[model samples]
Target: MACQREDELQELVDEARKIAYEGKVANYIPALQKQNPEVLSCAITYPNGKCVSAGDINQSFSLQSISKIITLAIVLMDYGVDHVFHKVGMEPTGDPFNSIVKLETSSQAKPLNPMINAGALAVTSMIKGKNAEEKVEYILKFVRKLCNDPDITYCNDVAISEFTTSFLNRSLCYYMKGGGVIHGNVEEIMEVYTKHCAISMNSLHLANVGAVFAMNGVNPVTGERVMPKEVARICKTFMVTCGMYNASGEFAIKIGIPAKSGVSGGIMCSVPGRFGIGIFGPPLNDIGNSHTGMKLLELLQEKYDLSMF
Candidate 1:
């Protein structure tokens, strides 16, 4: 379905863009530093195949931490909930997404949740593949199916940059490996993890993926099951509890939707069975969430009474 532009949404985007200066684009990745911090865009996809968008919706961005939800879904389907949770806890962490203090202080080395960098690395290690290439292909194939676009692929430059600089992620992997929470070559796991995190897409495609989860694992446009209903439930639960890094609780209290955000200033939200929302605004608050995008969502929630509460 053609996405019909909405003036109302455009107004919201304009309002949110004004706060872009309050935040900064992620610079640690090197590749993400090139983004325009003021750029803001949004797209919403419905079960009836209707879509509405505003702002710079065409600009593509890396998935970053948002890919964690997708990879968690894939691994949950490959391995049962029992096996997956055995490796990563379902609880959220109050510390930073990449912090390793809990990994060393916790009773076990298993990551507290899959949304964090440590847990994401552990989950990536579980993807069923003989090598990094095949594992990436498997993830891409699933992402393509969700977007209904076979051309979807990862950003090679971003992948390489993240792979080379992800010393913290590598350390997380080794810590888990030593604890018997994960097994494999550390470099191979890093290769797959970085590539999946670097998977790039515009706001519209991201909205579509969010819709798949909104409809309980069924692709709204294709009317096909993407994953089992239970898997989708687990993924959504995580999104509610841990998706927005450490700000998830405040987000839940305010916006009240199941959503995930990335360091690249992308937010993918599911309004239960209603619709899927995708937003990109490169400037991030101290918590690493899209500063402007969060404002936009707050505006939406206030305007439409969107809170599921």
Candidate 2:
């Protein structure tokens, strides 16, 4: 079965690769800029513990904003719905993920949604830990569980690059601290946020993590409930509403799946009760999603009628 799936998917990969040169790699992060923009890969993990792949599935990349969805789950479990919602909003923002304009304009001064940069940082601050290291450990442990790979860890180069260069994220943290929207040391929160954003993995590992969410919080391979059903539902809802940054609504109408994208050219997609997809195509479209990766998903959706809507 795996062989057949991979063979069939390879055709899609080849087709998708044709557009690989049409987009650009994320250049702001020095580490990310080192990626070859022409590279594209994909993996899909099914509920039955089967995973199939095409292209260079072994390629590793940071999660970037894709980490936002997982952190939200942790916080939701840590403080429950009421407490989590109070710190961050549930509405989607049409602005770019890093825009701080909404933070200043919102009546409550809270981030409009957890998927955006400001909201993700706010959510990261809510992670339970005595300090930055402990918080990072907790997040890594959870991610390792989700990926079903005990060795999964962050890329130091990427983490350091992001931490040092993320001036806008620091600004968001300081602004929120002043508004009483978030508490604790701003630098500590930034440390935890950047490390998690740098968590590195290949497409197969990412697909396994997405499979857990696709099965509604249960790790199909291990039969462990990593998160409650409610938590998973909320996270998936946010992914549909805000996962693609400002392009999420259009993606929903076109692709119709719950998915999250990272500027590192990684996209984790949960097809719900079916399978999960992980794609890495370093070239990014104008809105920051994987250009070739999006085409691959469109091909899959059209071939298999994968839309939930």
Candidate 3:
């Protein structure tokens, strides 16, 4: 099946590339401003250790907000779901990912979910670490294991740049802190949050991580259990609801599976019981998702009837 798909991968890439220009690169982040907005890349890995990839598959980009999925699982793995949920709600807010409305107005002053900025900050605070560097180290180590790529690394430049311009994120963190949603110094917690966002991956590396989620926390290639199946269930459930920012519903309707997109033009997706896909196209739509990446997934999902719905 993978061999068959490889034959037509270029056709899909060409089709998606046409619309890449409709969206522009995310320039606010200093390090991301230099990305080639026209580049479109994808890699899909099947359970049988087969892979089909095309375009700029070797190019690396920061994980951006997509790191939230793994971090959510990490905190859940360490603290258990009940404790993690106590700090953050289980539902999406339908507002922008960085919006501060619910954190202040909600009765409990909790974040609506872990995938958004406010909730991600709260969840990051829950990671059991004596300091920010230690917490981020744990995440780096675990994500490398998840991807099954020991060399997977963080982009310090991206992290420091985000930290420099993180006024809104800091506001969200401190606001949640005041409400008792997160317990830590605002700067320390925000570092943990944005630091994870800087984890870097090429399309293939990102797809490997997606494969774990698709395979219920097992790496089909190495036969390693990365997390409990129950934990993977929690991750996928959130990916469906909040993974694509407010466009999650649209993505689920169109592409119709679990997926998460990052600001660095990376999208990670899982086709339950089948395969995982990674995409990178720097230009972004109004909703802050990879423009060509989303289009390509829509086309492939439709052609292959991959929608879980």
Candidate 4:
């Protein structure tokens, strides 16, 4: 059965690549504009320690907004949900991923959810680091644990370019600081967040992340607990609720799985007891998700009935 699934998955990967032309690479970020919009790939790892991949699985890309998932989950584990929620609320804004108007309108000045820029800033502030460098190290350590790849490091070019061009992000950070939702040297925190956002990994490495969620934070291959079950649960909840930016609702209904999409055209999905999936399709759609990635997920779930909902 696994072999049969792989055969079909490979075909789907090929089909997904063809649809890349239907989308466009993220143009707002000057650094990301160089990505080959034709790239598309999928890597899947099942709980039983099997792996399957199709397309350009070796292509590297930054984690982008997807890193928010790691940061939020890590903070929740360290600070507990009560403390974390005090700083960032758990509701979606249904606005652009970087919208600042919502921050001003929010009653308590809390970022609507950890998945958005304001919320991610609040969450990053709660990461238990005494300074910017320590905070980045903590996040990098967690990312390495998830991928089990010590050689991993963020893309410096991407981080630097994002920092230079990110006028709106700086504005959002300062706004959050004023609202009292985020406290710290706003510059340091924003730098830390951008660096984490630049952590580079390929599709297969991302699949391992999904596989951990598949086992409820346990390394299925090693039996080591990678994350607490409760923390895993919260991460999955947010992935379903707000992982795909403004289009999250449609993705949830169509794909019926918990997943997160980054502006870099990467997605990580956890299939509970089945398998973990990571997809890279650099062309983005109207709502900032990888366009071909979204289509591929819909088809895979249809083929295998992988939806949890």
Candidate 5:
């Protein structure tokens, strides 16, 4: 049965790769604009230690907004759930991923959730670092340890490009500061958040990262406990509730797993006690999720019965 499932997963990977040809690479960021839209990769690691991958699994892409989940996890681990919640709420905001109106509306607008830009910046600020560089280094070390890939580094071109075009995010940071939700300098927080987004990794590494969460913070392959069980649970919950921006609701109904998407066309999913999936295709749908990537997850979920709920 395991071998048969592997065959089926391979078939799905092949079919999903073909859809990449129908989409275009994301062009907003100059760095992301150069991605090969036709490139597709899928990697899945089951809880019992089975694994399968196909297509351009070696292709690298920036983490983009996907870094939000990692930063939020680290913050929760370092500060506990209660302390983190005091700065950012867990409710899903029905607005766009980069919406600043929500931040300016009320004194209580504490960034809806950590998956969005506003909330991610807030989470980044809560890392307890003495300075911006310290915070970025801390995040990098945590991410490398989570994936067990020490070679992972920030893409300077991607980071600079995002920083140059992040007027909205900068505005959100200032608004958060005004609300007293973020304590540090606005520039420092934005720099940390943007740099994290700029960190690059391939689908295989991302799959391992997701698998760690799926195994409740333990890297099944290495037997390393990267985070506490409760922190992993909270990260998964946020992924299910707000990972795909406004499209999260539809993704939950269809895929039925805790997942997160980045504007760079990456999707990271976790099926508790089952498997972790990482997929990449650069074209984005209206809601900033990878179009082909979403369809691929739906197909995999239906075929493998991988839905958590």
Candidate 6:
């Protein structure tokens, strides 16, 4: 059965790679603007410990917003879900990812959920650390544990480039702080959050990370409990509700799986008790998700009966 799945995955990858160059790479940030639009990769890790990959699966890329899922998980582990919810709500806002209007106009200015930029920045601020460096180190430790790869490190070039031009994120942080949503220094939290987004990993490593959630917070490869079952369940709910920015509803309708996407052309989709799928293609659709990556997952879900619905 594993061999048969691998054969099918190869066919999907071939089809996905051909369309990878059809979209344009994200140009919102100088760091992401330089990525190769043609790079496409996919990897799937099954519950039985079998792994299948094709194309540029080994190529390293920044985690971008995908880091939000891992960071939110860590915040839940550190502060518990109830405590974290006091600062950020679980409801999805259909508005833009960085919209401050909702935060300002709402009775409570807290972010709608941890998957969005505002909520993730607030979550990053709540992470228990003395300073920016310690906070970043803590995030890296949690990410490494989930990926089961100690070598995972933040990409300095990407971090510096993003920091230099992250005016929107900076504005969001200040607004959150003023609204009492963020309790600490705005710069400190932004540094930690942006740094986490800059962490780099290949498709294979990301698939392992996704598998941790699919396996209910256990690292299937390392047999380590990276997060509690309840936390993983909540995170999965958030992923389904708000993971793909505003297109999450459409994705749920089409793919029927828990997944998250990053601006750096990475998508992490999980099929509980079955497999974790990772796709990378720098080109993005209008909503800041990878066009080809979304198409590939939709195809795989239809072909393999991997939908969670």
Please list the residue runs of candidate 2 whose C-alpha ends up more than 4 Å from where it truly belongs after superposition: 1-4
Residues 11-104, candidate 5: write the lDDT tens digits. 7767876766666677877889888777778888766655788768899899998999999988888888889998888899889988887777
Q: Give lDDT per model, in order.
A: 0.92, 0.92, 0.88, 0.86, 0.83, 0.84
lDDT of 3: 0.88
**What lDDT score goes with residue 41 in model 6?**
86
Q: Global lDDT for candidate 6?
A: 0.84
| C-alpha lDDT of candidate 1 relative to the true structure | 0.92
**Residues 189-245 of candidate 2: C-alpha lDDT, one tens digit per residue:** 999999999999999998988889999999988889999999998998998999999
lDDT tens per residue, model 4, 176-229: 787777877878887898899999999989998988987799875666898899
Worst 10 residues of 4 by lDDT: 1-10
RMSD of each candidate relative to the true structure? 1.8, 1.4, 1.2, 1.4, 1.7, 1.4
Candidate 2 vs candidate 4: the lDDT winner is 2
Q: Score candidate 5 by TM-score against the native.
A: 0.95
Clashing pairs in 6: none
Task: Give each model a TM-score.
Answer: 0.98, 0.98, 0.97, 0.96, 0.95, 0.96
Instruction: Provide the lowest-lDDT 10-residue window in model 1.
Output: 1-10
**Tens-digit lDDT string for candidate 1 (7-106):** 9899989999999999999999999999999899999999976789999999999999999999999999988989999999989989999999899987
List runs of model 3 lying over 4 Å from the truth.
Answer: 1-3
C-alpha positional error of residue 226 in candidate 5 after TM-score superposition, expressed in Å: 1.0
Tell how far residue 114 is off in model 5, in angstroms: 0.5
The sequence of per-residue lDDT tens digits that candidate 6 reaches over residues 1-309 is 122456677788778767776688988778889898878888888776567887788889999989999888888888897899999988987898878777877666788888888889888888878999998998888888877788999999898888888888888888888788788787787788879999999998888888889999888887878799998888888889999999999988988889999999999977787778788989998898998898788777767767688
Cand. 6 TM to true fold: 0.96
